[model samples]
Target: MTGPVSTDRASDEALAELLMRWVPQQRWFAHKSSSAHLQRLERTPLDEGGVAQLVALTVRTGLGDEATSTVYAVPLTVRHAPDEALAGALVGHLPDVDGAEAWVYDGPHDPTFTRALLSLVAAEEGAGSPAFGVHGTSADGGLPVPAGASTKVLGGEQSNTSIVVSAPQGSAEAPLIAKVFRVLSAGDNPDVVVQTALAAAGCERVPRPAGWVDGTWTDPSGATAHGHVAHLTEFLAGSQDAWRVATAAVAAGRPFSEEAGELGAATAEVHAVLARALPTEPATPERLAALADGLRARVAWACTAVPQLHEVAEAATARVDAVRHVTGAPDLQRVHGDYHLGQVLRSAERGWVLLDFEGEPLRPLAERSVPDLALRDVAGMLRSFDYAASSGAASSGAGGEGAGAWAAACCEAFLAAYAAGTGVDPREPGSAAAALLAALELDKALYEVVYEVRNRPDWAHIPLGAVRRLTSPPG
Candidate 1:
């Protein structure tokens, strides 16, 4: 009922004032448009030395009756031992109270926070467990942070926090990057299990794991918390994320034939590795039926949130109907989960190196972990290509002619490359695979529409166009 509480030494009055201003500044803060009512759920102390003591704050915000609470791992610094770099990254400034300035940690930066993050990653590698702390019985489980390993926050990453860890003195390589998992879920983290398995299977698309960290803690409500990825892997440097390169190619009006082809080949190889490493199961009618049901539910949800998704919803349903008749061995292999242009990297010599094995953001952890059609990942990449083209068009103010042409060219090149590399026929008829892919792409775009409308109303058009295109009759 009262304003949100802060578990820090700062008085409730100071914390409330800080929360009111701070909630609107965060990228992840859900209720930015309305006034926030804050309530503190929990806090953890980072240091016991009495100097540079940091606090992680979990706060709940409400707009009248509608409310949602999210845990934010914020680190605070006392005025006497202020961290300049940390202070500069503050999301919102607390009014100077009693000669102390309270600053919130910028989820994107903060070295002290990075150090704590590294502890989790080092814990994973040293302990021979998954980088994320998911405690499954699988071989890729339980990564623990090493003693005395430190971390430096990396500068890039638009959606997640990546921390680079310096191996303790007298180690083999320079520093390794440990990407801390932000969103928490109850199921096994795909990034840890799948990528680790791929690396073990000699898949060249992902960075090798040095270590991982994972564990469970009690929530404020006293429920047993499930394991989540704290951090994983020390990938090679000097590589560009595939999304940026693809967007650049589109914006410059350059044909992405070579890049798309390479991407396709790399994707095929990734699937092969996944198929080999993960346990397989026959694709029963029940599993396929369930997938269709899930897609239908997702489309229904999207239609409610974004009115523009109606066309996509109908088309997707039709496609699901067409695929319902085809019954083949449903191969359940570990997949990349959330594959896209951004989740990949282009290395100078090794070609496409995929990053972030985390799957679809909306799916539950168990669903993401369960092996499904490899074509699902392929569909995800195809959708990403559309997103890149649209994003570039929107940014450059390119008209329909330019954007449409570029999107078509990229799609063709990428498919050709992928087909050649994976030995899958892209043009084969009666396969029903292409229809399945289109349905998935439509589903992904619809999800994006909901997300963008809620978080960024301006960018909603990108997904809206995709929905319309998928629903329209072939000309």
Candidate 2:
């Protein structure tokens, strides 16, 4: 059996039906709950043979006033028989233009597509045709691609797909990893924008930029739209993320304060770099009130989704309101919106490298791109520590007291280091920083409840525990 002879409109229509079934199964797909009707936006053949296709889809989901839509780029490789390795990434079997059965595999998991992506990024190709486009630059303005480089897809990613490409044999250059953004939006991605700026500013706390890939397409409205589709960075060869390290330390009952302190300082350093590289603004009472309102909205939404949050709703709202009334709030600036231990890597050469500046991908890009109180990041990390403690205690069957103590110690140590580096005492009693941090922490925990409830019901208890404590009266 031969693969598709040509990727025409009819073939694309047949593939769209199959994609509706396949897309929702993917971990990176955004709208799992809604019924999706995929409308073909564009389909381009990457190779002259037409076996590999770059597809852009606009999925209209939900119905009536509840309707929503998102655009996605799904590259696919059509073959008669996919290799055993590609079995896990199979989209489905479909008939070719000649009506012969063919197998389709997701592009990021396919070597041919990955290589094409690498070539595009390396060559800095631009959109010469309506169907093809690419725009990216290396940190030092040069992309280096070693010959015979191969890609290995990473697992456990929730929102985006990533493939790690090895350096060519005996090459001194570090390995590269490309993150393919699942959801498509026009304009600069904060992950690429912020990391590039930080690297240019001589920041040592982020993976050096290699290059990126973007594409352009004519939307349903007949307007040209461009979007960042992927990003590449130097892969730390033998690094482990702080989440794994912290979990191990908790299980071993070892003090994680030293590492936590280091990570805190590293976070502060990144914030400082961002403040210098990007715009900064003083926080007014009005801004503080707006921030508080956002927090209250999140709490309300989360409580509606996970009724468990109802227990702590009032107290959470109160803490959030305290921020609006505070007289002196710290300056607002661009901060990592979804900071946690998992977002950091402990490299052998670089102590702490922050990854993923994309922020909460579920939020609108405009909201994620805005300057926020840096303490929001601090609050997220503080909540992460609690989650780690709770998970560790569950596995080890330790008492609640021990878990609480460990989390408290780690949070205290982390805050001390962060405060010292940034000159912001967020934990100081009755301070605006204290009120803001508490409110953010509460909001984060509530947000966690919604995620955990949807994804991992058993893990809901971890954040729910934090919610209870946050709402409890002071001893």
- Top lDDT hit: 2
| Cα lDDT of model 2 by residue, 1-475, tens digit | 1122444677777788888888887788888888888765566655545566677788888899998878887888877765788898788888664255789889888888777777666666543355544554445743475446888999999899889999777887678889989888777788988888888888989888888877787655556778788899988889998888887777778778888898889988999999999988899988888887888898889989988677778888887788789878888888888898889999888899999999999998878788898998999899889888877777777777888888899998899999999888987888888888888888888888898999999888888887887878766
Question: For model 2, what is the alpha-carbon lDDT of residue 342?
Answer: 89
Which runs in model 2 stand beyond 4 Å of their true positions?
Answer: 1-7, 80-85, 98-102, 141-143, 218-222
Model 1 scores a TM of: 0.77
How far does residue 36 in candidate 1 sit from its true spot (Å)?
6.1
Q: What is the C-alpha lDDT of each candidate?
A: 0.62, 0.81
Q: Candidate 1, which ten residues in sequence have the lowest lDDT sum?
A: 127-136
lDDT of 1: 0.62
Model 1 misplacement above 4 A: 1-24, 30-72, 75-80, 90-110, 116-159, 165-172, 308-316, 393-399, 420-423, 451-465, 472-475
